[model samples]
Target: MHTRNVVSGVLLGIGVATFVDETVFHQLLHWHHFYDRSTTAMGLVSDGILHAASMVATVAALFLYADLRRRRAFAPRLWWGGLLAGAGGFQLYDGTVQHKVFRLHQIRYDVHLAPYDWAWNVVAVLLLAAGIVLLVRGRR
Candidate 1:
């Protein structure tokens, strides 16, 4: 039960952090998105992005895994897996269609880093798969 609180807090925290970093810092500080790519600090921004994502993943991964352990709750599933999965879904969608087909920079948190895009999609898929596994196990 205690683990549940900690886990939920973590998931929520990750969502908040994502909102902050993507919406606030990247947008305001480095001018990653709103401004032109040439104007943005492409190299520093991309490297920093990967670093932050790794950190978030490291902590959020545990929270999500723990949520899956618990039988049922919005906190466990929604905040934990659903949020991460949703974020991942975005990556997968962005990578598959947005990057190639649309050529949209809807959310230009990173520079034109294909490696970052690839990694994001891969991790996003893993998060969704892990969430499904947890959901399946919880049903048993």
Candidate 2:
């Protein structure tokens, strides 16, 4: 596999991990709370669904990038892979540091947070921007 394929795969993995936590662990298993107690019943609506969608989208993007790479659609650059990476990277960072590290609200809770929270947000934004640029530039 090429850089794009590798990065996309990595990102997809990370995204999947996040989805499992949000949808399965958080929603299904009731391991923890969501944004608030109001979101306790996410059967109708909640962030858990969004997390699953993001995972699917990122993985789909990676799948497309991989197919294009195999066909030499954009052999030189894997711009699309970057977006997949960005999405995955954000989830990974959010999971590892924000959730696992500080135990902040189980899932993403980086709004109106502290300096470190802002720092993480900035990093996630940069990664997403870079990934988007790569994906747009590499698209064939």
Candidate 3:
């Protein structure tokens, strides 16, 4: 598997996960918004921006993967690793940067955040560890 393929796959996974988060949590579940300081309208705008970015990323990744496949350089193991890593990284960023550092919004409103934060970060760490292991094993 080509290294580029792995990277591309990761990008795709990240984008997809982001889209899911935006659609499910932001719109459907109504748990939280991208920026809690603003109105719901602003929140929708933020979600639109996020959705656009995710679409771009997903398209870019697919294009790159197609190119690599045409060249017969796609590697399954490495690509899977990248996918796991990308998804995990996004979750970690959301937990640490958005939820904690930025004070944007918690996983839920008027509820205990410790459990949500702990679970989010822990799952992210596991995903990252699994990705690293797969990447290393793939290289061997």
Candidate 4:
């Protein structure tokens, strides 16, 4: 149960999730931006900022992971659990706080949002649940 390993994994997970959101939804699909209440240029800037932050998190996580590995203190199960939890937590926050509360952005526009919202939150819950299970099991 190395705390550093879990922290590293969590950071990596957040980075991966943000990367996917930025690349797939924001770029490939032309979906909403991080801040939609602005012009296209502003949106692009916001996306760039998000991308940079995610990259920083990823690099930091990798460094931590490498250190854990070098010390032979890597806890695979705990790390994986943290990874899933972090990903799910981020998605859940985005889906709820960002999408609904702050109105930062929606999953998609000009569509029935109910289904997408439900699916997004549901998946987040599942991921979080699985992570919790793994973490509990790993403790034994």
Report RMSD (Å) for each prediction in the order shown: 8.8, 7.8, 1.2, 0.9
Give per-residue CA lDDT, model 2, range 91-129, as digits (tens). Answer: 557655755576645533443446544554566566566
Window of ten residues with lowest summed lDDT in model 4: 1-10
For each candidate, the alpha-carbon lDDT, in order, equals: 0.52, 0.57, 0.86, 0.89
Tens-digit per-residue lDDT, 40-96, candidate 4: 899999999999999998999999999988999898888898888888888899999
lDDT of 1 by residue, 1-140 (tens): 43443345445445544555455645466434422334346645653664477467646755655665665544444344444454555456545675556654433454766676667568768866765555444444
Residue 31's lDDT in candidate 2: 52
* Candidate 4 ranges beyond 4 A from true positions: none
- Give the candidate number with the greatest TM-score: 4
Which regions of candidate 2 fall more than 4 Å away from where they truly are?
1-39, 43-47, 88-112, 129-140
Q: Candidate 3: where is the Cα deviation over 4 Å?
A: none
lDDT of 3 at 107: 81
lDDT score, candidate 1: 0.52
Q: Model 2: what TM-score? A: 0.44
How high is the lDDT of residue 61 in model 3?
92
Q: In terms of lDDT, which candidate is stronger, 2 or 4?
A: 4
